[model samples]
Target: MPAQEDSSTRVLEDLDAAAVDYATRIAGASGPARAALRDELTRICLPFAGRMARRYRGRGENLEDLEQVARLGLVKAIDRYDPERGSFTAYAVITISGEIKRHFRDRTWGVHVPRRVQDLSLEVGHASMVLTTELSRTPTPAEIAARLNVSLPAVLEALESAAGYSPSSLNAPAGGDGAAEFGDLLGGTDSDLEMVDDKLTVAGLLLRLPARERRMLAMRFYGNRTQAEIATELGISQMHVSRLLSRSLAWLREAMLNDTLPRWEGANGPTDPHGMQIAVQSGGGVVTVQVRGEVDRDTAERLRTVVRHAVSSLAGRGLVIDLAAVPLVDAAGVAVLLDAASAAAVAEAELTLTGAQPYVARILGVSGLQSLMR
Candidate 1:
């Protein structure tokens, strides 16, 4: 027994002496030779590192990963170890253990956790285990806090943070039959969210219309009344109600798109000259208004007058506006067209706009008067 103990002591002394020589030589050596010597020493120390690694096994980390961490710590110890400070074995043991613990503290958590809370979590876990063994049951937060000499809140916080260490997968089955997942319990998209902007814009535009038009719109839409019902309530003909509702809604649509309200024509609104000319003809009870120039804010009133007169004497016949020579139409022109269409509806006559240029056609389409296009 004495010889065997002496033999073990000699082996330990030889290892310590060899470690000192390697450290001394590495400090003085440079280039590939120094690297070769460091590698040789690392190879010798690997068994010791692996032993240190095994102590931390079964603690929720792979044994191989912990061994790699320990070996990394071993290399750091060799690079930093000094002969005068202490024994190589003792220094290496501390470094390797610290590296393994740091791997758990920093890398094992599935989510970001404060370092203080992480350390407290370990303590709380240990205290729970001790109390569970002693009391033959899981310990409460207060009991665990008392065992760890901490506040109950801290213990509870640590317990909560423990879940972040290895979070359950969102795709994991939440039902016993595996038909549903955890993510299925989450809320879906709000379909009405897409219409929020449109609804708001329409609301503001509705306020800009006259009270009579607004009431007609509310009765026809909000109150779910037919054109005849709204006309009866307002003591107007169904055709008149149709005209007002059409005009109001079309104006709102144009306002929403342009982000500006177009001027509504009164019986005597001022007119300007944009080199515009209008010619009206009647034959077989079908009146036609031919326009020749750009129809804009400056000339919208002139066109409105000719179309209104044609509709007034229609006597249940159709009125056609020839836009073949018209070059362009603006928001004001679109408003006039909507008003013309409304007037024709009230007169029980169909109003059609024909031969509009591509640009003018697009303007009418966007103004919600595509139904008026021939």
Candidate 2:
């Protein structure tokens, strides 16, 4: 029995001599004669290739397919073999083993994985198997890492990525009774979860507002009352209630975004001590309106009125608003500029604004007026 096993496993000396002779002959001849020589050499080496392929039989691949891969590797070795380099047996063994391992590494993954991670996963898996046999139990990641001289995190990552090798389908049954699928375990996006930060921030901001503004906001929103009803309850005009609500809401939005509170104007008007002034000059088919001082809610209407007169009085020419002296402009001021641009458009006149301060220019840019700037 021992002699028979040895005879079955042993490679013949004539096979090596034939391979070297065939490789030399095939390199110089490319016709049907060269192909016949290569085919004959391959038939002689079939038993040797089958032995290499059998080493990987139980590794989740069919034996016949592995043998085919090994045979293909043998053909490549024959084509590439140089007679003076080394023995054909050693070269063919390396090539055939490499081809089989390459097939397993590249083709069997159910999910895409990095080559490094896949290699590490195989190392970790082998280590776990060896340690399990020695320890007589399933080895932990730490044990595998210690045995392989790798970091614990690396072992853990390898084990986690190994799941990608054979990922279970989302539609697959999750339990013994098959009542639920794996997809049933996933949770959906919660709509209110995204608003948690906003709600917390608004709650903190509402506590910082004045008593009257806070009370009015609660009455209008939480209590669901009209502005006129709020005005009557607070003993103020409905217009005043509307202005206060707009101002408070604007301040809250600014505070939430910028982390700075906007200055709240007095009941009479904006707190800007320097009142706005508008001076218009006409020359050379151009009307230039020179503006001075800060433009806010209270002063925006005056600027709007002056710009309107300039637009209506144009005689087939252009209008230029010089803002060199203007220091600051609010949202209301920007609205007036947009209104002027629209009226000029309707009159078939071109309007250009020039010489705004850096801060005021940024405000205009944020207000979508950058195209009109000169």
Candidate 3:
């Protein structure tokens, strides 16, 4: 593909001269004229996402998949864009970034990112969101640890995964009475009728989730048990259950964001994205959880499912994340903490981690997540 150097360097106004030609081609949308213009437009927007893509290149398991994500953003910008909305380059850049973020979020739920990893990442995001929502500002890493009852380092580690990421809120509308908002945290999952059928509904999306995530969702959402109760039922510690639930909610969130699932002829299945992760959770009323042992990638998925479930089910008003036996956590382990943090935010629970190691604190400080706690 030929590069549009002007779109890469020159201003949008200057690019307008070229835009006019493409506009005609897009408007034409019929023949060779349209083909040439579409190709040209793609050429122009592709490079805008290069810088952001660089950050996740080797970091992301699939580089080709990442570029496709970037391409998806570029196309969306060209399609919905107006030449008048400032520089086309700037517009493309924003669209590209949005696309990349969306990919990360989706990947966090659906694929290249394991369901467990995404769940943990979601927790960190949720914690940050909770701080911002409750205090109307960014809370420091210390506050998060204080809230979860964990040590300063654990909180920092959780925050680290969310360094360049921001948390997203469910657009659940305000009720008519506008009653106590936090009190409403005691409600059930707000699944729509769309999830009832065998296609785009919650059940269908559940198929995409990993087996552990699927089972937890069932016991929690369909069983109607508290987090602690579920923990007893599953024979896992209450904290383990809590962490799993929290991760589950994050996956459900990602799945919910995927409103459309393609259905094949005679096959009611959605084609999984090239790279993805889908967060989903909701069930029960209140929960208390307990966790032990050092967390790593191998065990991270279990942790994520637990945390997400805890949050989505509104298991309790507060969460106590006990890290007493956890001696060391790698980068992947930190990701799991983030997962629980994100869920706790939505469930309106105070998440605290207890007995963090000095080594953990050093990791958190190096990651620059200390600022998220108050």
- Highest-scoring model, TM-score: 2
**How much does candidate 1 score in TM-score?**
0.44
- Candidate 1 lowest-lDDT run of ten: 265-274
lDDT of 3: 0.59
Model 2 residue 79 distance off true place after TM-score fit, in angstroms: 1.7
Segments of candidate 3 deviating more than 4 angstroms: 1-17, 109-374
Cα lDDT for residue 236, candidate 2: 62
* TM value for model 3: 0.29
lDDT of 3 by residue, 35-152 (tens): 6777787786555555556655644347777788888887787777675665566677788767776677765432244434444455555566678889998888777666656677
lDDT of 1 by residue, 90-197 (tens): 888889888877888989999889988988887777677778899999888999888888998988899999999999888999999999999898889999999999
Error of 1 at 13 (Å): 6.9
Best by lDDT: 2
TM-score of 2: 0.48
Please give the lDDT score at residue 149 for candidate 2.
Answer: 93
Cα lDDT of model 2 by residue, 1-374, tens digit: 99987765465556678877887778788699988998899999998999999977665678999999999999999889898988888899999988987887788788888888888887777677679899999998888888989899988888888889887899999899999999998888899999999999998887766556789899999999999999878766686678678877987898789866665432222333336668999999999999976566657889999999999999888999999987667777888999999999999999898998897899899898999999
Model 2 misplaced regions, further than 4 Å? 1-15, 27-30, 130-152, 175-179, 192-374
